[model samples]
Target: MRQFDRGEIHARLRAVMDRGEPIVMGGAGIGLVAKAAERGGIDILMAYNTGPFRMAGHGSLAGYLAYGDANAMTLELGREILNAVDDTPVVGGIGAADPFRDIGRLIGEMMDLGFSGITNVPTTGLYDGKFRAHIDATKLGYPREIDLIRMCRDRDVFTVAYAFSTDEARAMAEAGADIIGAHVGLTSGGWIGAAATLDIDRACEATQAMLEAARAGRADVLVVAHGGPFEDPESVRSVFERTDVVGYLGASSIERLPVERAVSGVVRDFKALRPRATRTAG
Candidate 1:
């Protein structure tokens, strides 16, 4: 599998960050979406079978549901995405820290499949309080995320760690994540979304906090923001003006959200055309 070392990965990331044109990384559940993102010049493609939840008429949160095997799904889609896109590096959403699976073995398998890097998905980031504690007690929680990224770093495979808080950001950065994505809940305002309760300014503040924590661990940790107020480019730009994040991750934003808007308007336009009562001319 073609792979980018840590230096090359950061160089590519820096090139996009330096240009200020925005680095576009899309999460795709299917081949068509992956192909489309590549055509649009997306810098990276993240594959998680859960992305198909929208195709099944469910929300992106369905990616975290108990239905499918997360690792299995990602590898299945990751390979297909690589085949569909010409050169865009694909990130596999590994279900890190699952006690039922050997994370080390899983990482090796992901590398063998030609993945350019890995990221945590179907993450336990959203859970909190007793539920979160219970997961951690079982040893199948975020520690797995840290270990998984560390393993990848050992091999020099690129890694993007999804952290929901400043503390999590610190742990991930210290664990050697090449890119630390500060995820702020689910992308909202679309069909089947968790309301993005945090205002844009607050989200930016939180992202800055996360960046500060990561930098405290490693000065060069590349930080990106995703979800919530980052559901669109305009929203991201709003936050960008307020924070120092390096980039954004457009899962629902780039894929389902735009498709929903565009397809709705397109169908409406087609339906609006006058009927045969007007006598059509070619």
Candidate 2:
């Protein structure tokens, strides 16, 4: 119900960094998760195209597939997430390369929707091989994401840009991203997560490189690690230890994995309940 300006968001995060605690931006697709995450003192709440799918127990990659309109889904999910938390800064994800909408109008619409800021998601940076080449050739690529970040910056909206490589990181930073999320790969864990891709050590190295690149472009830009081995607190700690990353931006790692574990475990416990006649007296 509350809205935050860019300066206020920066000040809040800066305060967190000064306190020596890693900031956590949690992905929330549903109201309960958003409310709970706010109660847990999350630094940011992110709503994006893939989040609803992930929360629905589907693979997050489904957002990138041709099932539905990605940007429309994000705005819809953003409204739900925004309505849930009282004051947490919610960063709405935009599919920058969506050809159907005017980019500037989309950014304006997100701002008007009570989102505290913006981020790139359902991103082309996740694609590769021939598909990647084709997208790049057609102008529906990472560059459009950078342009989105720049537009947000011009509007004085906070921006957290996700980057899959050092070049991408630097580009986003140069385009005025307030924070750079060094995206290693699809998160690896839980039932629907991607298979273990990079080990912790390797993921740390890659994350460090991307963060460094972001810093190279904008010396004061905040940096965070996301995806790949950064799925759990332990792995995220390693990233903090090895890189200058001050935080983490979690998608599936936040909403899906923990939900999958907790819900299934509780249901299993309920299933294990037996009749009194089948139970032995204590």
Candidate 3:
């Protein structure tokens, strides 16, 4: 199958928005989950290297805590994702801050492997206080992400960026991110979620700021949201009502483990009941 470039990605996003439905970008850690998302009619798949962590009964955020070789795991997942789904585009989740990687070479390899787009993960936003200060001092955080997005644009690769703040959104947009995603912590209620840091209204408030900031750099830049209070359909709708965000992204919220929790409970109800004959007289 042919891979989609940035233009095709942007056009597809716009078409979804036109339908008055925010595009859904589901994060799948494995092919089984990815195939499920495709059948559900989601617009894109965000396959993160951190995905394997989800399979290990951890949140995708644990990917940031450093489980293993992220780049290595992600490249292997990329192969599986392409093999699993067709026509549905996938945005490769990249830890762009890895200093050992050659940005140019990485982009080329990913494109060759049939990735439709790219996004930064295990992001700098996860750091705080002294660790954040240290990351800044070492120039190994958002700086690397900024430069990586530039390289992607130069190579005409599709790009999606995660921004925890308006400033980060602006930088990514100016660097040619096709999609500027406002991240609001982990999705609440997932089996392994970090706590929701903000309520839906508050997250939308923050997302609005990000959208305005990103638009300043590229007026047509597509805006999306992920994590935090935007967990269910109601919460996602609340966000859309309050902000101009065009869509949402899901990690554990879209994958098998969380659904497994729901499914297990439902199936237990039937198992608890005794079988009874419905026919009385013949």
Candidate 4:
């Protein structure tokens, strides 16, 4: 396991940012993927709770369902990811809204496990309507995610937090998050992703709004785009052309969609290979 202090992690990311090239962060669920990502020049690897399910041919939404404990699964997956990457900073995505866990202890354990940073996932911000309201009223909500960022800051741990709206982005910046990921919605593409979501224009508008809000809270806070129409380099470039996002955080875009396309295409090609004619034997 490779360990990086908060300063070291920031320095590494800053080096990339200073080079006039955008940073790239990929989500990895397994060691093989993590190793390949690092080798391919990925600046960061996020061991997200949803990553395993996404790579397992299941929907990323499975992380939000009651299938398993999000935080625990993230930690367990983080260990595998940590072992595979040599130096790329790996951030652990924690379910900060969990009511039964001691979040402070969990943060400590993540740091000890060689994770270079932390982030919020399986976040309450993903829910809305009466369900979201109930979560807020129950003291289990986005505020806890903010508190998680604050806790990481207090411990000198780097953070890349997801924010679904301007308010969430502002709050995350105020809480000392190093990177604010402008999450427009569940990523739209791939077999199990959202069927419909914000288009490129709307995604850019939403991302810009959130990044602006984050900057208003903390002028130097880094902003990255995630989810929605950012499923490929071209689409992501559209966002870069339209917004001030410094980079992109790819979950399904990195792990699921490409794998799905590549594997399916290769299998089809193999199936298309016809047997040699019997005349060859003659």
TM-score of model 4 relative to the true fold? Answer: 0.96
Give candidate 4 regions above 4 Å deviation: 277-282
Q: Could you tell me which residue pairs clash in candidate 1?
A: none
Task: Please give, for residues 133-235, the per-residue lDDT of candidate 4 as tens digits.
Answer: 9989998999989999999999889999999999999999999999998999898887788989988888899999999999999999999999988999999
**What lDDT is reached at residue 226 by model 4?**
97
The TM-score measured for candidate 3 stands at: 0.92
After superposition, candidate 2 runs with Cα above 4 Å error: 277-282
Among all windows of 10 consecutive residues in model 3, the one with the lowest summed lDDT is: 273-282
Q: How many residue pairs collide in each prediction?
A: 0, 0, 0, 0
The window of 10 residues in a row where model 2 has the poorest summed lDDT is 273-282
Q: Against the true structure, whose TM-score is highest? A: 2
Cα lDDT tens digits for candidate 3, 1-282: 447887887788778888888788988888888888899998989877778788767767678775687877888998888789988999887777777888678878888889998888767876778998898898888878888888888888888898888899999999999888898876677556766479777888899999999999889888988878777777888888888888888777788445767678889986787656643535
Per-residue lDDT of 89-134 in model 2, one digit per residue for the tens?
Answer: 9999999888899989998898999999999987899999999999
Better of 2 and 3 by TM-score: 2
TM-score for each candidate, following the candidate numbering: 0.93, 0.97, 0.92, 0.96
